[model samples]
Target: MLAGKRVLLIIGGGIAAYKSLELIRLLQKAGASVVPVLTRAGSEFVTPLSVSALAGHKVYQDLFDLTDEAEMGHIQLSRAADLLVVAPATADLMAKMAGGRADDLASTLLLATDKRVLAAPAMNVRMWEHPATQRNLATVLADGVRVVGPNAGEMACGEFGPGRMAEPAEIVAAVEAALGAGPLAGRHVLVTSGPTHEPIDPVRYIANRSSGAQGTAIAAALRDLGARVTFVTGPAVVPPPAGVAVVRVETAAQMLAAVEAALPADAAVMAAAVADWRVANAGAQKMKKDGSGRAPALEFAENPDILATVSRGALRPRLVVGFAAETEAVVDHATAKRLRKGCDWIVANDVSPATGIMGGAENAVTVISERGAEVWPRMAKDAVARRLAQKIAEALQ
Candidate 1:
């Protein structure tokens, strides 16, 4: 989507400034011309040489460079690019932008830009959630600036929450959305991922070892294709991607409700590892031993079948995709599951512990549809997601 377009990327100060290098590469690889603008604080984490090397363009940093001003004035520079992006849009930078500060080259260009601006914020979780930052964010948003993510996850400060910068792929997707029309443009997709916890008590629960990497990848992939994605996710180890509406749930029941609420989607992908059963009589308080020399005998009740329910619902999505995790006869099981669940397609993978795919980074999956099954070679989860998302684009078309 970025082919032949020019992007004025302003790198901001933050640990995530390093990710801008990769973002530049992804942009260029997609045939976009990248113009580098590195801030003074941004240079603290990444060198000008490295930024210049990756972007294949000279780094512009000084606000008053005589040669630069003589050739391309700051205002002209802003007008030249098709889009302006700020990765690692730190709290300070964003605050300044909200206040229309043009104190330096980066801020000056941002102030001068007549084009749409996208910012991917990165900061400490507390700072990100702070009232001042929120006010500034609202200010920028009101200024017609678009925001990607300060996704939830582990941060550089050893704290875990919603402060991490969106991944390079995710930011690239947002950039594409800002710049041109994508394959899934104007489409809405709903994706469920991660493992649901069937609580036995406040302190313990039942859950599978699903890291939600595949689902996260899939959501990112769909977004990259320009789909408006509603991601209904569980407690995933990997954080949710940017540029999508996320609904967090803990139980299968909650997931079902969230999915149903996010209906009217063009497509739906059910990839969560939902527990089949939840405790029938979950105790309000933690269970205690009474020195009876016996463990508690708990009863179980079937949890809502999210995939089947959504597939069979009156508001069924146009394309319903489910997942089948099997230890044996993966394709056959998924094929049967597709029919049984009334889904249009099924993605099957072996999670037999031996495969190490349950919580692993890479995956080997078989995509089963009504036409037949297609065996996908073992590869990184992101690649598989890209392929599946492409298939979805074709199917929807």
Candidate 2:
């Protein structure tokens, strides 16, 4: 999708700087010509020589290099690319950009550039959540600068929480989404993701293996296509995309309520693995293991089907998509599910224990519509989401 695009890649100083090298390789593989801009501190983590070697171009680092400046002024250099990407965008750089401080080459180019700029922040959890950083992020977003991720996870410093940089592949996809043709602009898409938890007690609950990756990806992809997305997600490992309205819920009932609230959207993608059943009468406190050796019986009640509910609503969306994850008879079961659910389309995939597709980086899906079923080749989940988003855009047209 990025073929022939010129990417001005600015590497910042952070532990995640190493990922920039792989990002360069991926960008080039997708037919993009990368121009490397290394910050002074960025040079410390990854050498300019290494970046140049991977990028297949001379790396630009000095702002005062008279020879280079005379050949291509900073103003010209800044506007030379289709997009400016900052990977491992440190807190310091973000602050500078947020405040319009152009002390270094990277910040200077960022200020001088007219092209769209996307940043993937990498920092400690505390640093990311600090009021100063938060304020700066707000300023940049208001200024039309795009932000990708500082995903939540274990940090390199042994501290666990948010603040990890997005993976190279994810960054690439974000870039494509940013630069791709916007066919879904002005469209409103609502998506549900993750596995809903049905609590039996304070300490116990029922859940599934859904990581919410696919659904979140779909939301991001739709956002990239210029659609305003309302993402209704359960407790998910991955963070939702910026520039989208995110509604968090924990149980199937909560998810249904949130989805209903986000109605009148152009489309709805029900990718959440909502619990089939919930505790009939959940206990408020934790159940104690009594000395009596008898196991307690738990009563169950069926949860609402979010997809079917939305499909049958008075304000039904123009297109409704649902997911069916099955171990056996994948296509057959998925096709049956599409009819029963009354959704316009169903994305079916096998998530058996042996496949490891569930909560994995890749997926193989069969798209079932009113016409028939079509199986897709195994690909990254993000790619699958993009293809599906594009299909939705086409259908809308």
Candidate 3:
């Protein structure tokens, strides 16, 4: 997918900077020409000679090198690439990008580049989770920068959490997904996944059995098809897919807000298993049992119906799909739901205990549309997602 592409790769300072060498080799193997830019601190880990040798190009480092300035101006160098990638994007680098600081060659190129940028963050666990770093991340994301991972594992600091940079293969895959051309190219799709948690008290809440595997698969499939996806997900056991804009939320109301914020898409898939009701009279603290042995009175309120709202909203997409996980009469209930919710289609599955479909790897689904129901045989959720994504691509076309 990256054939004939020009990638301006900025190597950031971190132990993960060593991985950028492998990333350069992988990018070259994928048929992309890499222009290396090494940061001052980055040189401590990987030498510019090795980077330039692997990339087969001059490594750019100084912002005011007279020879570089005379040969090719910074503006041209920055704008010449199809995409800019920052491997091992340290917290400091990300903060600089967010704050628009251009004190160095790398940050200057990032600031001057008009092309899309992708970052593979690497930092300490505490640094990754810091509020300032998270704010900077959110800022960069809102500015259209794509992120791959700071996956969870043992860190070089002897700490374990989410701060490791993504593997070279994963970064390459994300680069391909970012630059790929396919049926859904230039399209934007919104997807919701997982189960919302309705807080009942400080220590307890109500949730469902949704693992978010199917929805994650669907988002990845859409991304592979070249669509820009906004994945609004609730508290899910399964992590979200790469190469998509992810918005995490805890409650149904928060999910609804996130969904609404990511509006005016070409298509929307409401795959979340939202709670039907929430505790209206939730306790400020954990509700304690009285000595009389009677439970406290709890008031219930209806949660927002995301599917129906998205389908009927003013900014509704051309195609709005919903999912129905029913225990009985799945097809009938799903068909009725499609009509009642005013959605274009409903992907329904029987999630009874006997089926073991919910939170399971496999799925047996029925697609309900205006024409009727089309039953599909049991298969892996990934397969289901690919088929459905193809259908969505066709519909959008």
Candidate 4:
């Protein structure tokens, strides 16, 4: 999608700066010409020689180089690219951009550029969550600047939360999405993700091993295709993709509420593994482990089925896709699920412990529609998502 595209990459100073090498390579492999502008702090982590070697071009690192200025002025340099991308966007750099401080080459280019700018933030979790940083992020978003991760994960610091920059491949996908002509442009898509929790007590809950990778991938793919995605997700291991609206929930009831609120979308993908039952009378406080001779018996109640409700709603989506994770008779069960849920299609995958599909990178799935079932070979979750997004686009057309 990026063939013949010009990507102006700005590498910021952070531990995650190393990933920019791979990012440059990926962009070049995808036929993109990369022009790298390294910040002074960015030079401390990765050498200019290294970036120049990988990009196969001279790396620009100054705001006032006589030779550079004589050839192409800073204004021309800033406006030369189709898009501006910042990897490992440090907290300091983000704050500078938010406050319009163009003290250095990178920040100056950011302020001078008229092209769309995208950033993948990397910082300590605390730093990312600081009130100042939060305010800066809000300002950047409000200004129509596209931001990717700063995803939640174990950080270089011993602490863990959302502060990691997205992987190189993921960032490349985001770049392509930003630059590619959106196939589903101007469309709104609603997607649900993760395994809904059913609380039994304050300290205990029932849930499944849905990492939400598939759902997150689907949302990203749809965004790549130019769709405005509203992601209603449960407690997902992965963060929602960039440039999309995310509504977070934990339980089936909360998921239902979120889904209902994101109504009238062109399509809905019910990819969440919602719990079928919840405690009839959940304890408000932690249930003590009393030394009772007899075990406590708990009552169970059915939870709302989000897919069925949406499929049968008055504002029914034009395209409705559900997921069926089964251990046996995958195709049959998925077909039955499509009929039972009244959805237009069902994506069936074997999540049995033996298959290692859940919480894993690769997936083998069969997409069952009213026409028939089409089994896809095992592939990366992102590939599956792209294929599904294309299919959805065709269906919408």
lDDT leader: 3
C-alpha lDDT of residue 382 in model 3: 66
Instruction: Tell me the whole-model lDDT of each prediction, alpha carbons only.
Output: 0.89, 0.89, 0.91, 0.89
The TM-score obtained by model 3 is 0.61
Q: Extract clashing residue pairs from model 3.
A: none
Residue ranges of candidate 1 with Cα displaced over 4 Å: 1-6, 9-64, 75-80, 85-175
Q: Which tens-of-lDDT digit does each residue in 173-255 have in candidate 4?
A: 67877885456877899999998889989889999889999999889789877799999989988767767899999899999
Q: Please report how far candidate 1 places residue 245 from its true position, in Å.
A: 0.6
lDDT of 3 by residue, 1-397 (tens): 6789999999999999999999999999989999999999999999999999999999999999999989988889999999899998999999999999999999999999999898999999999989999889878977888787766678999998778897898688668767864578899999999999999998899888899988988897788678999999998987786568999999999999999999999999999999999999988998888799888888999999999999999999999999999999999999999999999999999999999899887799999999999999887686688679889999999
Which stretches of model 3 miss by more than 4 angstroms?
A: 182-190, 194-225, 230-271, 277-397
- Per-residue error (Å), model 4, residue 394: 2.1
Clash totals in order: 0, 0, 0, 1
Residue 136 lDDT, candidate 3, scale 0-100: 94
lDDT score for residue 205 of model 2: 97
Residue 391 miss distance in model 4 (angstroms)? 1.7
Residue 116 lDDT in candidate 4: 88
- By summed lDDT, which 10 consecutive residues of candidate 4 come out lowest? 144-153
